[model samples]
Target: MTAAVVTGLGVTAPNGLGTEEFWKATLAGESGLGPVTRFDAAQYPSRIAGEVTGYAAEEHIPSRLMPQTDHMTRLALTAADWALADAGIDTGELPEYGIGVVTSASGGAVEFGQRELQNLWSKGKEYVSAYQSFAWFYAVNTGQISIRHKLRGPSGVLLTEQAGGIDAIGHARRHIRKGFPAVIAGGVDAAICPWGWVPQIASGLMSTVDDPARAYLPFAAEASGYVPGEGGAILLLEDAESAAGRGAEHIYGEIAGYAAT
Candidate 1:
């Protein structure tokens, strides 16, 4: 069996924007949970959440893509770019068919869907963008990343909620074992808008406490429910032998074993 190793990481987390920043804050016991500012949540039962602060999409994404993509897709694209750069991958030098992408999503792009629906009802059906046809799909992240980087190898998207990220990585490893040299495998999710909140609230698993510190205490005596958050991570997964041949730096770890029920 070919060993799959992680060569790079890109993180857009509530606590930090990059891997180094996130790790430092986590070690110091810092918290990113706070009152929701994406929208007016005063009337909602859950008023607080972990939002990715200080992120300006304009800085990371091209202006042309702004109109077509949602908040989550933008973040995913930026994360994928960062991961590829971190891995020192020069797509121009490698065979495009030898690289692949596999990611996971939970709720798709509710923010974009909500906006399109508003336009449809307020104006007319013609006002809705054709991009809306695929923007809200759960596989949009994987498709967008693949298109952006021109990775023409085996690609796929998994939708197993929290376990989806791991499943995607496992699938990527399978592809690598099948002879692909490199793969981008991870997950990114952002559904912190009104339409997205509706489903989370309906699930009855969201924390109602407004206090950030007191909320989202899982497996504790004071545990209520959990706080919802936006942002996730992307990672570069490469075959171990191929990584060594290319003089790849920063081998974080290996996917020693994976099994799913």
Candidate 2:
């Protein structure tokens, strides 16, 4: 039987830019939750969030592609790049059609959508860019990542909210079982903008507590709600046999089993 194993991991989280930083913070029980800064959250019920900081998009992405991509897409792209590097599998040496991308995105690109809408209303339709059409779509990450990497295999996007990331990996495992060499699967989300906040606020699930430490107590009875966060993770899923053949190091545990109803 074929098997899928995690060879590399890349992360862009509110706490850290890459896996190393994120792991250190996580191990120390440090919280990334803080007062929102991307925009003024003064009026919102939930004024705090786990926003990614110190990320320089230009450092990870080419300037030509920057303007066309939204923040979430940038996170996804960067994470994927890091994941590929960590795996030691160079795309330049791989078969294009053998590599695949499967990702999950819940909010799409709220900031981009919001800005485009504002342009449409204030500056007329002519002000909007052509990329606006798909920049904010939920499936944009998978499409963009696939194109950037020249991956022509079984690519797809999952939309199961928080569960989507895990679902993406499961799907990739199935794809590998069916004969694809490998798949990049993960999730990225950056929906803290005005438009995004409004919908989240409407859900009534966000924490309104002003105190960052006491704001999100999910396990306690005093748990009012949870703080919102933005970021994503990317993982390289290669079959066990192929990974061993290529001398890939499995630092993380292999996917022993997967099931979804």
lDDT at position 134, candidate 2: 96
lDDT of 1 by residue, 15-80 (tens): 999888888989999889999999899888988889999999999999988888999999899889
Q: Native-vs-model 1 lDDT?
A: 0.90
The top-ranked prediction according to lDDT is: 1
Candidate 2 lDDT, 1-261, residue by residue in tens = 898889889999998889999999999998889998988988888898889999999999999998889999999999999998899987666676888999998889888989999999999999998899999998999999999989998999989887889999999999999987789999999998889998889999888998889998999999988788899799999988888888885547677778888
Q: Measured by TM-score, how close is model 1 to the native structure?
A: 0.97
Off by over 4 Å in 1: none
Number of backbone collisions per candidate, in order? 0, 0
For model 1, name the residue pairs that clash. none
**lDDT of prediction 2:** 0.90
Candidate lDDT scores, in order, read 0.90, 0.90
